[model samples]
Target: MISSTTMGLLVLLALSIPVGIVLFLLGFGIDAFFSPFPLIRGLGNLVWSTSNNATLIAIPFFVLLGEVLVRSGVAARTYAALDRWVSWLPGGLVHANVATATMFSATSGSSVATAATVATVAMPQAERLGYDPKLFSGAIAAGGTLGIMIPPSINLIVYGFLTQSSIPKLFLAGLLPGLGLALGFMVIVAIICLLRPDLGGERRMFPFVQMMRALLALVPIILLFTVIIGSIYKGWATPTEAASVGVFGALLIGAVFGTMNLSVLHESLLGTIKITSMIMLVVIGASFLNFTLASANLGGALEGLLDSMNLTPFGLILVVVGIYIVLGFFIETLSLMVVTIPIIVPLVVAQGYDPIWFGILMIVLIEMALITPPVGLNLYVVQGARKTGRMGDVMLGVIPFVLVMLGMVALLIAFPQIALYLPETID
Candidate 1:
C-alpha cells in the first residue's frame, strides 16, 4: 500500500493532475486495492466532516483581506515607504524589499501575495538603479515567506484546523521565529551586498524628517495587523472573528486612501472565492485520504516501521525535515501541507514534540519550499515581475536565503524557544 501510494502520487503529479484531484484518486486507489471493507461508501461523511469545519472559515476571510490590501494599493505604498528607511542599509533597496515583504506578510497571511506585491514594486527599481537582479529579486522571494510564519497567517489557521491545535497559540508560536527569520534575511543580504557593493543598488540615506513622513504610509497595514492579532491575543475574538475585523479594517483603509470602489470589492470577493475553493478542494481530498489511511491502519504500520528503525528523536526530526525539503521541490505549498500534515504531524506529536512548535517548524520548511528551485513559487513570481532578466538569475539569487533558512531550521532545533516562548508565556 505504501509503495503504491507513493508511486501513484508521483505518477499522477508528473502527469499534470491537479494536486487535489491526485489526492482523491489516491484515496480511491487505497480503498479499492488495499482495504477489505468498502471505504468508498464513507466518502460522503468524510467530505461533510471536512467541509463543515467552522475553523476553516478563516481561510476565506484571510484571503479576502489580502485581496483587499493588494487591490487598494496598500502594498505598493508600504513598499515605497519602507524604502526610505532601509535603503540606507548595506544592501540598499534590497533591504527595503525584505523589510517591505516582512511588513506586508504580517498583514497579508500569504507568501505568494507578499512576494508578488514586493516584486511588482521593487523590480523596476532594481533595473533603473543598476542593482544586480539576482540578489535583489531573491530578497523579495525569500522575505515574502514570512507571511506564513507571522500572526494571522492563513497557513497556521489551516494547520490548527487540521491538527486540532489552538490557532491563537499557533499564531503566538510563530511570532518570534517569524521576526527572527526576517531579521536573518536582512543580515544575510547586508553581508552579501557589503562584500559586493555593486550587487545592491546605490545606498541612499533619506533625511530623518522624510523618513518620519514615510512612516505615515505604514500605519494602515500596521493597524490592520494589530486589530487582527490583538483581538485574538486579548481574548476578545477568535481567529475567524479577527479575520472579519481585518476585512473591515482593510475596507476602511481603502476608503482613507480614496481607492475603495465597487470594482475593487468585486475583485476581492471573486479572488477570495477562487483561492478559497482551491484550498478547500485540497483540504477535502486530504481529509478523505486520511480517513482511508486510518481505516487501513497506516498509522500503526508507520509506527512499526519507525520502531524497526530505532531512530532517536532528533534523528526523526532530521528525517522529517529531509522529507519536506524533497517534497518541496514538486508540490505546491498549500497542497503539501494538506497532503502530509495529517500523516506526518501525528507521527511527530506521538514522538513527544509539541504540536505548536512543530507547526512553526513545518512553516519554516514551507518557507524554504517557496524559495527553492524547480517549483519555487516565489522564484517564478519574482521572475515574472521582471521584463528582462533570465530565470536563472532569480534561481541563483535565492541560494543564500536558502542557506539562511537552513540555519533557521538548525536554530529552531537547538533552541525551540524561538518559536515557543510567546505561546507559552502568553495565555
Candidate 2:
C-alpha cells in the first residue's frame, strides 16, 4: 500500500493533476485494492461531514479579510511603515522585506498571499536600489511563512479543526514562535550582511520624526489583529465567530481610511471566493483520503512501523521533521497538513507529545515548505513578482532562512515552552 500510494502520488502530481484531485484519486485506488468493507460507499457521507464543518467556515472569512486588507491599501501602508522602522538595520530594506511580511502575516493568514503582497511591493525596490536579489527576495519568501504562524492564521484554524484542538489556544501557541521567527530572520540577515556588506543596500536611519509619522500607517492592521485575536482569546468569540468579527473590523478600517468602495468589495469578494474554493478542494480531498486510509487501517500500519523502529520521543520528532522537509519539496503545504494530520497526529500523541506544541512545530516545518524548491509556493510568488531575475536566484536566496528554520525546529525541540507558554498563561 505504501509503495503503491507513494508512486501514485508522485506520478499524478508530476503529471500536473491538481493536488486535491490526486488525493481523491488515491483514496479511490486504496478503497479498490485494500479496504474490505467497501469504503467507497461512505464517500458521500465523508464529503458532507467535512464540508459542513463550522470550523471550515473560518477559511473563507479569513481569506476575505486578507483580500479586503490588500484591496483597501492597508497592507501597502503597513509595508511602507515597517520599512521606515527596520530599513536602518544592517540589511537595509531586506529587513523591511521580512518586517513587511511579518506585519502582513498578522492581517493575511495565507502565506502565498503574504509573500505575493510583499514581493509585489519589495521586488521592484530591490532592482531600483541594487540590493542582492538572492537574499532580498529570499527574505520576502521566507518571512511570508509567518502568515501561518501568527494569530488569526488560516493554517492554525485548519489544524485545530482537524485535530479537535482549541483554535484560540493554537493561536496563542503560535504567537511567540511566529514573532521569534520574524526576529530570527532579521538577525540572520544582519549577520550575513555584516559579513558580506555588498549583499545589503544602504542602511540609513530615518529621522525619528519621520519614523513617528510612518508609525500611523501600521495602526490599522494592528487594530484589526487585536479585534480578531482578542475576541477569540478573551472568550468573547469562537474562532469561526471571530473570523466574521475580523471581516467587520477590516471593512471598518478600510472605510475609515477611505480605501473601501464598491469596486474594492467586488474584488475582495471575488478573490476570497477563488482562494477559499481552492483551499476547500484540497482540504476535502485530504479528508476523503484520510477516511479511506483509516478504513483500510493504514494509520495503524504507520503507527506500528514507528513502534518497530523503537525510536525515542526526540527521535520521532526528528524523523517527522525530516519527512516534512522532503515531502515539502513536492507537496503543497495545506494538502500536506490535511492528509498527514489525521495519520501522524495520532501516533505522536500516543507517544505523549502535546498536540498544540506539535502544531506549532509542524507550522515551522510548513514554513520551510513554502520556501523550499520545486513546490515552494512562496518561491514562486516572489519569482512571479520579479521581471528579470533567474528563478534560481530566489531559490538560492532562501537557503540561509531554511537553515534558520531548521534551527527553530531544534529550539522547539530543546525548549517546547516557546509554543506552550502563551497558551498556558492566557487561559
| Candidate 2 ranges beyond 4 A from true positions | none
lDDT (C-alpha, whole model) for all candidates: 0.89, 0.90
Number of the top-ranking candidate, with lDDT as the measure: 2
Per-residue lDDT tens digits of candidate 2, residues 45-110?
888999998889989999999999888888788878888898888999999888888888987899
**Cα lDDT of model 2 overall?**
0.90
- Clash count list over all predictions: 0, 0
RMSD of model 2 against the true structure: 1.0
